[model samples]
Target: MQPISRRTVLAGASALVAGPALARADRWARVVAAARRYDQLHAILVAHRGRTVVAEAFRGDGLDAPANVKSVSKSIVALLLGAAIDRGVVPSVEARLAEVAPRLIPTDAEPQVYELTLQDLVTLRAGLERTSGSNYGAWIASDNWVADALSRPFVAEPGGRMLYSTGSFHVLGAALAEASGRDLLTLTRDWLGDPLGIQVPPWTRDPQGYYMGGNQMALSPRAMLRIGNLMRRGGRWQDARILPRAWVEACLTPVTTSPYSGLGYGYGWFVTQTSAGRLGLARGYGGQIIAVAPDAEAVVAITSDPTQPARSGGYFGDLLSLIAEEVLAAT
Candidate 1:
């Protein structure tokens, strides 16, 4: 046998390293190409095993520029709840709204509302009439957003079926504010923003100046991926424990079901099965999503046009397909 030359040995080793990288790039290219077919999609980003596999902007803002995440704000609020629990600011998920923010609970609220826990709010199981969809305008028009939400008639029982109500999350945010003695913006900036190194611009606020929690928050696509990664890694970020692993697990545990999409609803996340593994999805209006596949070691974020709607039967379904079939497949 011929002795291999030093230069030839190095060349062979380089090819060995480059081959898998080239294949990964090609796969990600296909994923990006697939994403471009959606007119509403503004950006798609994917990170696998701590490395960014793809990041592309098709329209609207750049990947790093903040865009309206719509109801993904709900998911962020849920995360803040976890952080608050980790810091002992609000006790635990079992803490009752009446216990934490009695001032925001309207006197006319059903007696059962006082017994509702933080879990009920985060899981959309507060059993209150929904303020989302057609009721959104009237709810926001009220003088007191928290009181208005709390005053809604009982639609179910607390800890019952998912109501898909943004009002539930809004109440949760208000409770957090009352408990922490800090506004939503400050909590977000201090807990998630500084740790993840992302910007969270202030979004809408209620008449009483509490930041709206379930809608209108803004985050860049890159920032969304970081949030996904935080969950995917079980609440740790870059050597720091941003959230307790137990809290992350509990957050992803399915507690209810979304009536609109038929997906299992956890604490501020939608749970679904993917080819790769169980996915924890944070979705917003107009197709915005942050999908985390912990078993697959991948996280994907997509942002879409804020003005348009992406219903489950339409554009949102298409986005889910793209993530499960193309994006996760590549990862």
Candidate 2:
């Protein structure tokens, strides 16, 4: 019989420890391979059953440093709204903007603007002309962002159409600040940053000092994945409740549909069917995203080029394909 060597015993123990980890990696190797294909892909992360399956950084400041997540901040804001409501800072989504923050309504603004609910704002149905895309420049460049947003001409009746507008969310952010007596920045850090152990860095502020909402948030891929996990796990993280489960459910459920992407729009999430089952997407400009598939017990986060547009079947669609075709399939 061979001598019982210490090195051999350690090797056997190491193999025992590595066995499960190696298997987990192998289970998602196809996803990792697919994620690595994009040159502009900043970072990609995937998790399953409360375990991290893949985390890779490519173009952005690695995984630890913050990358601008663009409009995915709207989803983060939605999470804060849930926490605020649970804490009684906000009465409900039905709270009218006029009652909550009457001062923000421009003097000559459309009467409907004064009646916009928090629901209307977060759901991008404020009925105001969009304050994003080409209009975003002038909107942000205004002297008073809140008033400027409120002053936009009505393109549809309040709650009539899903007009994607950052201004609506900006006003919502301001109202959230006034309601909670804390700026969106502080609320975000307290409600989400501390709970998830993720850094919520200071983002661009509006002219009136309100934290920019629905856009220009900085979160690392690791932090973004933490958020994704919080949502995928139904607003709980490690047994600590962050968001009301009900709010998370409603956000994941579709309330409207996007004309461009043909995806269902919930509060901050875009709902669509994928091979991975019913997937809810928290998307942003330039492809930043948090894709949560409850049925698959998986969450995937991606941060892409902040400067470029990621249209469907274009670069951003490739990111979705990575999740729909590869990650979900691998699972």
Candidate 3:
């Protein structure tokens, strides 16, 4: 091999810096230091303009180790749903859920159940009794997760309100698989993983062999950042259109205002207005997050232990917001 030229070395170094001059130094350092101090976070990945600016693994997890991304998996499922639609596997979001999975619906199902649509599930307005709040532990322990999720009684009129439910996304996953004649993991690998060069490991499946859709999906921090970056680029990876532009816009658009946090939630992402601008995020239980800010052309992924309450919203969200405010602000 020929000796490397000074110009080639400088070009390589320049590519490593994510964005403009400000992002190359103090801004990147501040984010790394803050995450270490506050959240005891396992890994942090920051990308700017489609390049890795800060990619560091910590807390005993290697860069390739898959981290359980909890509810952030919902966002991944959302991508699959969009891809399914684009491929003509599913007709449209307006399609009724009962029509898609008639076998799953009880013969004497509640009237509200009939009213639930694919759109309602994606937006978390399906009106099903939620599995996220008080019923979380029980839902996890149940052997027949899909049956248990579909068995929930209607608590409100479909499309009348928003209720956070992992079960809703689970149902969507099931419907997609049923319609496509492929398993959730297989569909995801074909639609997303293969195209993006991200490996989503063999996901945990229910007894029925359906991959769990809304939670506990495993991906490396780098993989998580790639997903965020895809969204940041309007669902296109490099030159290929992995998801439709319309679907991406719809997924990121706010559907309901959150009752607990005042943030806006869309299909599977949370929309928050911070000092840096509008930030779209996939927030998982226990402080795992993949935040994408289009205005800044930035994506940040973080993973932390969920059992630690202080680390959850207190440090994780704050640290990311601070990075946007203090670091990205200068840029």
Candidate 4:
């Protein structure tokens, strides 16, 4: 009696057409080999020039089931911020935290918190004491998510380093709601879900009822593709422009370097260096990834063991091989 994910509502067309594109040159054979071997992998979806290339599910989860995308939601949040900016719900990224939501700020917070802008939170460089890696559990269990985030001690200057904290994004999500006078759910549904023809189901919420900002969002594999296509197509879905083009460009332009993948970190995406071109991807914990190869005009979405690790040199490296050696080589 759980709420149905309703993923089957969207997989028919992709399943039908995916066979042909994957069959050519045994390109899909490599993908099949990898899928069958990795018990952790659940789905691999690749699309080229607006058509489904490979849409195959391995074992753990069905292709038409919703999977926990974890931190990939961070990228989606970035997109929502962009749309909000377009509509003037919030000013540009340069706008300070005090300007956006002074009411949400803690009266006893360190002075540095007031200096932060929307840009810092999106880039994961808020310089707050870390709340993501070892601190994630305690941060979420706090009575007030926004207050706890704002009250964290500063580890560096406002824009100095990438602290990679979920608290930063969580606080920013509350700030966004305060600035727009609209909840995050409404903004997401109206700006993205409706235009892309995808469903945005409710997921985990902090104790105060704000949606978990940077992690724990769920989506069907096909829905992930729709999001990648939205970015690949420069924030447009068909004739309707979902996110502003300028925002798309700005998100891809690397502002800081990542210590995790040793890649360029844009707004929320982890930008990688590839022989083909700059590979901009929405990477989550485990092997959950949405890779967009703009040079190849291709988009690939992957969902794997969300509970397992997918570091750059291990399982994640193999996944990237499928994209670089198999998917891109075929092209």
The best candidate in terms of TM-score: 1
Superposed Cα deviation of residue 24, candidate 4 (Å): 3.3
TM-score of 3: 0.89
- Candidate 2 accuracy as TM-score: 0.92
Q: In model 1, which regions exceed 4 Å deviation?
A: 1-13
Candidate 3 whole-model C-alpha lDDT, 0 to 1: 0.80
Q: Write the per-residue lDDT of candidate 4 for residues 173-229, one digit (tens) a residue.
A: 777778888877777788888889888888888887788888888888998998899
Model 3: which residue pairs collide?
Answer: 286-306
Model 2 / residue 49 / CA error / Å:
0.6
Q: Write the per-residue lDDT of candidate 3 for residues 1-331, one digit (tens) a residue.
A: 9999999999988877655565456678876776677545778888888888777776747667788888898988988889988888888889888788777666666777776798898888888889887898899789877778767888877886788899889888988989888999899899999999989788778777788889889888888888988999999999998999888877788988767666788877888776767788787877788888888888888877755542334665575565677546634
lDDT of 1 by residue, 1-331 (tens): 9999999999999999999989988999999899999999999999999789889999987998999999999999999999998898987899998888889988787889879999999989888899999999999999999999988899798888889888888889989999999999999999999999999888899999999989999999999999999999999999999988987887777877787888888889999998788988999999899999999899999999989999999999998899899888887
Per-model lDDT: 0.91, 0.86, 0.80, 0.83
Sort the candidates on lDDT, descending order.
1, 2, 4, 3
Clashes of each: 0, 0, 1, 0
lDDT of 2 by residue, 139-230 (tens): 88889988988888888888777888888888888888998778999999999999899998899998778999888999988888888888
Task: Using lDDT as the measure, name the better of candidate 2 and candidate 3.
Answer: 2
TM-score-best of 2 and 4: 2
The lDDT of model 4 is 0.83
